[model samples]
Every structure is written in C-alpha cells, then in structure tokens.
Target: MAEDAHGGAEDANVRGTPPGGRGSHISRDHAAGPGARGADDPKRMEGGVLVSIGALLLGMLLAALDQTIVSTALPTIVSDLGGLDHLSWVVTAYLLASTAATPLWGKLGDQYGRKKLFQVAVVIFLIGSALCGMAQDMPQLIAFRAVQGLGGGGLIVLSMAIVGDLVPPRERGRYQGLFGAVFGATSVLGPLLGGLFTEHLSWRWVFYINLPVGIVALAVIAGVLHIPVRSTRHTIDYLGTFLIAAVATCLVLVASLGGNTWAWGSPRIIGLAVLGAVLTVAFVAVERRAAEPVLPLKLFGIRTFTLAAVISFVVGFAMFGAMTYLPTFLQVVQGVSPTMSGVHMLPMVAGLLVSSTVSGQIVSRTGRWKVFPIAGTAVTALGLLLLHRLGVDSSTGEMSAYFLVFGLGLGLVMQVLVLIVQNAVSYEDLGVATSGATFFRSIGASFGVAVFGSVFAGRLSDRLTDVLRGQELPPGLGADALKSDPKIISELPAALRPPVVEAYATSITDVFLYAAPVALVGFVLAWFLREDRLRGSVTAPDATQTLASNPVERSSYDEVCRALSVLGTREGRRQIYEKITARAGYDLLPAASWLLLRIRRHGWAEPTALSEHSGVPLRVVIEAARQVEERGLALREGHDLVLTEKGCGVAEELAGAREESLAELLGDWWGPDRPTDLVRLVAELNSELCGSDAEQPYEESVPRPAGRVRPGR
Candidate 1:
C-alpha cells in the first residue's frame, strides 16, 4: 500500500474543539497534505516547513558532497592502497549499490513510512562513512563505499519524495529550485573540500567529515520532522527487485570490465552481456505480473515520464563522465595542485548556479519548462564539442569557458527533469516515479563512467605505447607503470614528460568528443517531450477517499469540492464563491473568510505575505483587511493583525455561515443525518485548499498566536 503523502495523523482543530481542548475523535478518512497540519502538529504553523527543508538540504549536501568529493582524492588513495587495478571498483561499487538500492528505498518508504526509513538511511550512511574512514585496504574501502552508497541512494530519493509530501505540485517548483541550488553549492564545495582534506590533511578526513553533519541532520529530522504514518501489509516484490538489480549490475560490470580487465570478446565479458540482456527481458516480464512492481511498468506508458527518464539518463551520462575526468586532466596535464584544480572548476559551478537559479525562477513564474531541457541539452552538446577542441597547451581561460558552458547546460536539465516526472504522476506514485527517474540517471552515471573510463584508458594506453615504443626505459620501470597512475608521468624524465602529458590531454579530449553525441540524443529526445499543463496545486484528487466513500456526498459534493479545492490555491476561486452566493441569495465573503482562517490557523505574519501565498491580489487583500476592520472583526495592531472578541464572534459566524451554506446546498443529499465528522471534512477541505503547502517566500516569517502573545511577552 502506498503511504499517505503527508503520512498518518489526525488534527487538533479537526473537530470544532477550540484551542486547549480535545481534538475531535475520528477515524482516518483521507490523507492530508503537509499543509493540512492542525494546531496539534507542533511547529507546523511556526516555520516548521522551512526548518524541515533546511535539515533536508543538509542531508542533500552530504549525499552530493560524497559523490564528487572523492574524485580529486582518488589518485592519492590509489597510491596509498597500492591497488591500481581496483581503482575503478572504488567508484563502481558505490554506484552499483546505490543504483540497486534506489528503487527499494522508495518502495519501502511507501509501504512503511518515509520518516523512519529516512532516519534509518541517515544512520546507515553515517555508519558506512565511519567504516570507510577506517578502511586500510582497497577491498575494505570498496566494501565500505558500497555500504555508504546504500544509504546515499536513500538520501537522494527520499529527500525529493519528502518534498512531494510537504508541498503541493503548483508550489513545488520554487522549492525544487532551491534544492537545485543546494545541489550546485555542494557540487562546488565537495571538490574544494576534498582537495583541502587530501592536500592539507589525510584523505580519510573526506569520509570522517560526514559524521558531524550527518548527526545534525539526523537530530533535526528526528525532532522537527513529524510524519504521521499508518502501516499496512505490503507485497514486496523481491523477485522483481532482484531481476532489475541483476540487470543493472551485469550491464555495469560489462562496461567496467570489458576492454579493461579482459578482452572485449572474452567469454566473461560476452557472458555478462548476454546475461544482462536476458535479465532485462525477464525483469520486464516480472514487472508485468508483480502485485506491486518495484519499477512500475505502467510508468513507461506515460509519454512524458518515459521521455524525461531517458533525458535524465543522457544528462547523467554526460555529466558524470565529464566531471569524473576533468579534474584529472586539470591536475595532471595542467600541472596544478589538487586545491588549485578545484578552484579552477569554479567557473563551471558559477555557470551552473546562475543557470539553475534563474531557470527555476523563470519556471516558477512562467510555467514554461519544456523549452529549458531542449535548449539545455543542445547547449550541453555544444559545450562537449567545444571541450573536444582543447589541446595539451590549452589556456586555463579556455578550459574554464568550456566548463562554464557545460555546467550551464547541466544545471538547466537536471532539476527540470525531476519536476517533469513528478508533475506527471499522481501523489501515490510520487515516491516510485521519483526514485525510478533517479535510478535511471544513476545507472546512466555508472555506465557512462565505465564506458568512458574504458575509452580514456584505451586511448591513453595506445598513445603512451606509441610514444615510448623505441625509447629506452628506466632500469626498474616499464610503460605499463605509467598506465596505472597519472602521477607516474609527472615523476618521469623531464624529456619524456611532454609527450605523455600531451597524450593524456589528447585522450581526455577524445573521451569528450565521443561523449558529445550522447547529449545530442538527449537534445533530440527533448523535442518529443509533451508539455503537460503544470498543475497549480499538488493535491492528488484520488489520494483522499472521503468523498469517494460517501456516494451521496460524492455526487452532490462537486460544487463543494470545487469550492474547497481552490480554497487557498488560486485567485479564480472567487468565481466559485460568486456562483455559490448566487444560489443561496447570500453574500459570500471569500476574501474575508480566507483571511480570517489564515489568521486563525497560522496567526499573523504580514498582509503582503498572505496576498502572495493566497494568490489574491495585494490590493484585494488590503481592501479585505479594511472591510474586516470596518466590521469590527479585526484590528491592525502595528504590523500584526489581531481579531478582537467581537471579531472572533464574527469570524465564527462567517465560518458557520460558509459551512451552513455548503451543507444546505447538499441538504437534500445529506438528509437529516449530517456527517459526524464535518469538522474533519472542513479541516481536510481547507487543508486541501490552503496555500500553506506552497513554498514560503524568501523573507522568512515567524508566526505566533494572534493577539495571544503579548508584545512584552
């Protein structure tokens, strides 16, 4: 069973119970969005969402940092561990474990609950990090890195799934944009920090650093992150998961081992290839029959989902392939220290930050997201081709420019694809869809690195052999020694250095030149993506079963449903109210009612904030404030709006009036038996309606109980 997006929980104001009184007792009817939190959920109304997001970003930082931070330190690790043959395994192990675990985490989160699962993931990640730091050999490190990847996979997927739980779809872009920025920031920070640790301290510090941050993130999530959950028995698809994992592992192993550890036509490589293909076919068959498939085959039927998943794969391929090798080229060929190489990568990070932040804001404002992916992938292809132009003597400025273009293209594509997939699915499928897309991207990264590693190694080997063929070798060293490590070339005879460095530079460029077409495929795929209309809210109509369970209420509740649906989301809900008022021959106070409820639920922040969040025009909100003041319903004490005793009575009357009017409209269908849980329905109704699920404005608002907290207090 798919868990509720917001998890399990009832509300304090769920019944007509006043503050400090017992909440209405009721059975679970429908899952409420995070915005639907009652007065009972501690801190929901008082900057809790922002606080929770802050903690999530820290978790995201840890995951992203680990992926790239180890890049610059890899050479040093190889030198220390003396396992040049197992170098790729260090990265491959993590990617393989992470790829296999991604879908399972999402499925388990749905079956159980996200909060506990996410917390467990954090603990596991921290434990793995400590183990990695303690590892004394290559095999130990690889095994520990696999452990880290297991937890890392959950960190990436669950953090995104959690956002779906808290924010509605309409408001998701803004937060997604922020998350993009966080990813970008960590990308830059990771390399720089890794370089610093490897250069000034021990490379082991790279893993140890996760301890403090992970602890803080865990504490924050455990204490501040409240997800009410109800568990039901689930048919876990172990067979399907195993088949998919097998397919991914086999394919990645082929890419990593073929042409490197063994000949391309070797029996081991050929058998693995055939096995992977057969497993893929079997996996598809398994998914078609599984009660709850790990990766739902139905998702493939969605055109946008399929297209976005492919594009995500291509982007990941190009991105990881380029990022993994660029620092090596800079540090070895350019003769820069690890720290300087990380600093030099700043141009790319800057481009990414600017493009991602700007594009996200544009998407939020305009909702025209399709153009970005098309244009971004095209630019990414161009950037890769430009990188192919670099030679051994290329200037730092030239390299930075190429990297900048690449980063811009990457930034534009990455976040939007996730948004596209999320927007395309229902809330129940949010976790699955999210992890599926991530799984494909991760699989792509694994293969891209493996394939490109093969290409780079082959090209570099051929060039090195060509250059060193007739030359006299040193007494103890041979050509194969240079193939194992780049640092060996730096330590070679001065006369032999230029040719080897030039060969490496040429090979790196060759890798990019060949990889360009992969991004081009993404550009082409972007054109086929259908632009589904972006929703104004994230409410999944089917997720809540309240109306569906009540046949009469379900049939007659259309107008009420329509009214409640737009309660706090859109500006056009006013028209729905106008129609409601017309039928009852009563004036409807849409603005006043919304404002009063806003004040009641979250207390006061600012008039302008309410306008922005509620989607009402600022002038309309200001005028509504005036009308409420004139009616003695509210008074502006300084910047804060307070409801007096008389105002509270009027507010109650307005609330009662709206409910009575709605009930009367359905009176015939409802008959004399009013729903016993009208309060829960209203709360759920308004919860679905409220814009509280929307992203908070840039200027943080700390709301307190209106008029309850004295100025001195």
Candidate 2:
C-alpha cells in the first residue's frame, strides 16, 4: 500500500514536467497540503496556499513592473545617447518580439508543464537583461530589448495560466485581486524606479536592475509552485506557428514603422502590408490542418471565445497606446519631470487599484465575470474621449477626471477577459486558450504603443512647423529635429524655448484628438461580446480552474436513465410528476434521461419513427415535447427531436455496459471526433448558439426528419 502511494506520488512528480524540456528543471513540489493539519501540511489548500500565492504575487509583480518602468525611461535614454529620433524603436522592438512570441510560450507550456515553462522564461529574461545592460548604441539596445521581450511575454501569461492549473476559478478572485493590485502598484513604482535610475545612476542600469529581481523570482518558482502533470501524446504545430509569427511580426512592423521610418504610402510599408495579409490567410490554412494547432480554428467557431479575443485586441490597441504616451505628454508638453509625472498619474492608478480589488472580491464571491466587461468597455470609451480633449489649457481637475475614467475602465475589463476565456474552454486546452487571449492583447498593446508613438511624433512636427512659421535659426536644423527632444528644446538658445513648448503642446493635443475614435472601436467590439452563463460547479477559485467538466457520475447517470425509461412508458406516462418526485430524492432522473435520448436521436429520425420507437403518437409527442423541454428532458430542435444537457447525460448512462450496444451506436457515426463531441456534449447545445446553421446545409437542403428544408434555417 505504501509502495502504491509512493508510485502515485512518483507519477504526479513526472506529470509536472512539460513535454520536451530540460526535464524537472524547475518543478516546485510544494503542494498546498493534503488535509488540514499543523503549519507544515502543504496540500490542505487552506493556509499554506496563501503563503505560496504571496510568493506567486511577487513573481507576477516582477513581470508587470518591467513594462511600465521602461516607458518613463525612454526619453532619458535618448538624451544620454544623443539619438533622440530612436526613442520609439526602443518601445516598438520590445512589443514586436514579445507580441509574436507570446503564443509560442503558451503552446510550449501546453506541451510541457506551466511550472517548467515559467522558470525558463525567467532565465531568458535574466539573460536579456544582461544583454540590454551591455548595449552601447540605440540599435543594439533595441535589439537586446526585443530579446528581453521574448521572455517577458510568457512570464505574464504563464503566471496566470498556472493559477488555473492549481485552483478553481471561483476561489481565484481573492488571488486575482493580488494580480490586479500588483499591476496597479507596479505602474506607480516602475516610473519612480526609472526616474531614480536616470537621475542618480546611469539609465543603462535600468536594464541591469532586472537581473537580481529575475533571480529572486526564479528562486520563488523553484520553491513554491505546485501542479499536476499528465503525460500524453504531443504534436507541435510548426506550420501554424510559422504563419502566425509571420503575420504578427508584419502587422507590428507596419504599426511601428509606418508614417515614421517609412511613409505610410512607401513601397516598403505596402510590401509588408500585403505580406501580412497573405500570412494571415496562410495561418488559417495551417490551423485547419494541424492536429495540435496553437489556435484551434474550431475555437473561432465558438462565439464566446472569438468575441472575447476581439474585445481583448481592441482594448489593448486603444488603452495601452493611449497610456504609453500619457507620461510623454506630462514630460514633453507640460514640462513635468519624470518623477513628478509618475506622481501626477497617481489618481488614475489609484482608481484602477480600488475598482479592480472591489470587483475581484465581488466576482470571487458571486462567480459572475461577464457583466463587468460589457459595462467596463463602455466606461473605457468615455475615458478615452475625455482624454482626447486634453490640451495645454486643460485644467488639472479635468485631466484627473479623464485619468480616473480610464483607470476605472481598465480595472473593470482587463482581468475579466481572462475570466471569459477560462470559462469558455475545457481544462485540457486551458494554457493554449489563456495564451491565445493574452497573445491578442499583447498584439493590441504593441500596435497601440507603436502607432500612437508615430501619431505623437507627427503631431509634434506639424505643430512645431506651424509655430516656427516665421522663425529662422541654425543652418541645417529642421523643425522635426528641434521638436524631437524636450530636453533639447529646454536647452535650445533660451529664445526658442517658449515656441518649442507651444509646439510640443499642440502636438500632444493633436495625438489625443486622434486617439478618441480609436478607443471607440474597442467599445463597439465589446458591445457584441456575448454574455455567457457561468456553469456553476463545486470547483472555482480563479479564472483558470473554474470550469473543468466533472468526471462521469455513473450512479447519477443510472438513476436518471431508469426513471426516464419507465416514465416514457404508457403505464407511467407522467414525466412532469416523475421529475417532481425525483427532485425530492435528488435523482433528477426522468427529465435528464429523456433529454439525453432526444439529443442522441437529434431529431434526425422522422417523427413517425420516433413515435414508433418510443411508443407515442407523433401528434402527442410534438404537443407534449414543449412540456418535456420545460422539465429539461428534451429540446425541440427546429422541426426535429433533440436532447438537452439533462437528456444527453441520461442516455450515456442507459447505453449500457455491452460492446454490441456501443458498436451499434458508434459504427453509425464515421466522424472520428464524435465520441469527443459527445463526451463534451458540445453538440448537444442549441444549434443557434454552439453549432452553425451553415455546417448542416445538406441536412437543411435535402430534408429534415419530417420534411424538406432550406438554406437559412
């Protein structure tokens, strides 16, 4: 018995390793305690879970902190290097590489284990940090930063994905509060840290700082992260990965370089643009055929997942882009120092902190995550418009209100996307699904920052040229170079200072004017994001582990089937009464069984055949079918008979333990995935919702079980 227990433990240990990695390199075997006990019992999932999660909290903070910290430091880096024109590339490069690689990390994690992949990401981050610190020129710095970004993408998402692996989604809110708090707190801290380094230490040390922090994070992951690993057949989808990477890179490049390094109408821009379109189409082709596609083409067929991804993309595009330029506005246009800008932004950060914490607690308690996004996206659009109207004469009070709106919107929608994606997918696909969501958002943020940076630059130039309409100065210095750096503007011969500042102000205002409508697109996308009913279950602590389908509960299945079969008989033809009686015993038998059989039959059989088989007249079956559905026994699928969730479960149980019975049913369906579809009961859902009306066009055009059909419905 002890050996068997040891073997089980051994098996679990092996499962923690992902598919093809340096095996067991970073498996943190500290389970949250098996049963409630002394302080040492780890698997109990009560107290020790908190301590480990606290460490996880710190680890997540490390990743979120890096994104914002670098933003405030960009201008300072340019000042030190005498390469003011290269500032946008620094931010663009980081986003471009990170955005493209985000899906890959998630895919690899799916092949291996989340624990190992996260550790690998930390190590890669550490290496990139060293390279960034050593960079001597603008181009080298941008290149190294891109490398750092590759590692950074996986760190943020894998941390969240790990939560789903260990805990249920409902209970995850308290922990999600930790994630929100970390993001909120870090936004404030990152800029402060960046300012401190730029002011006292060299700006290069900003890159160096990540080294020690990443090592500490690596140690925490080595000690406390615990998860189960199950060995399974694995296939990496190379064609899909290549195609996706190509399109993502091209799209980001277009955003980053268009209207800046290359004209919007330039041949280079047009070529990359066409290349991106072709790559995206090719990506769809690869996804369709790959057995383990990074993106399941079928997932797009799922309304909830696709809408959530779209909303996430649009939100990232508008929000991140707008926020990235906000600090630049404070420093360049308003003449606020970096430290002061970070402090001035406190109201926005505070609003995010408060709203997200409160929302997390409520969502944790109620297990409802859909409504927040529907409303939050609307709020976000309002904030974007408010920010759009900002200018040199805009009051601090007005600015604060705008920032508050932006913060509130972010607090509401940002984390909810994670919840929606988690709810919509099965457990086996958790890492990929979570990664897909984060990937789109990352792509959005990249485009947002890149495109907005160009807008800010262009507006600044136009304003500068307009303000200097009559002024003539140095021989070769054009308006573009003069307006490039605020520090240079401050030092520009004292006479040029006021006009330069005015030009900066005009450009900043123009950028805001342009940013307003971009945010509205996200608002419109969010409107279409469907509200999915949360499947209430025993397990739910966080977004990741909230929606795992329970194993087949055989006894419940048997009771439901027997009761339903008897109730269907003429001797006991009262399904409503049987359902009511079964409810008292917690059997839920008759209704569940009846629904299961109908779904299996799928109204594919003619009404006469169904009537003959079940021993009921066709007319009575049609009339009473509505009542049968009310009891949750069966569903009337258009003009045919179908089963609901309750019905499907009962039928599976009643199908019996005999191979002949299995063959009789299985042999008729040539579709390889039919068994999997049945197990998930994904098809048993309403065709209007889960299945497409277009997919069964042949069924519609030829005939239904009862009569001829048409294309539309």
lDDT values, one for every candidate: 0.66, 0.57
- Of candidate 2, the 10-residue stretch with the lowest lDDT total is 546-555
TM-score, per-candidate, Cα-based: 0.73, 0.65
- Give the C-alpha miss distance for residue 707 in model 1, angstroms: 27
Give Cα distance to truth, residue 376, candidate 1, Å: 1.6
Q: Write the per-residue lDDT of candidate 2 for residues 235-337, one digit (tens) a residue.
A: 8776786787678778877876788778999999999999999999888888888887777777787677888787777677766676667777777767677
Best by TM-score: 1
Tell me the lDDT of model 1 at 118.
Answer: 86
**lDDT score, residue 414, model 1?**
67
Model 1 lDDT per residue over 532-588, tens place: 765443222220111000000011122123323333334345543433333434342
Best by lDDT: 1
Q: What is the lDDT of candidate 2?
A: 0.57
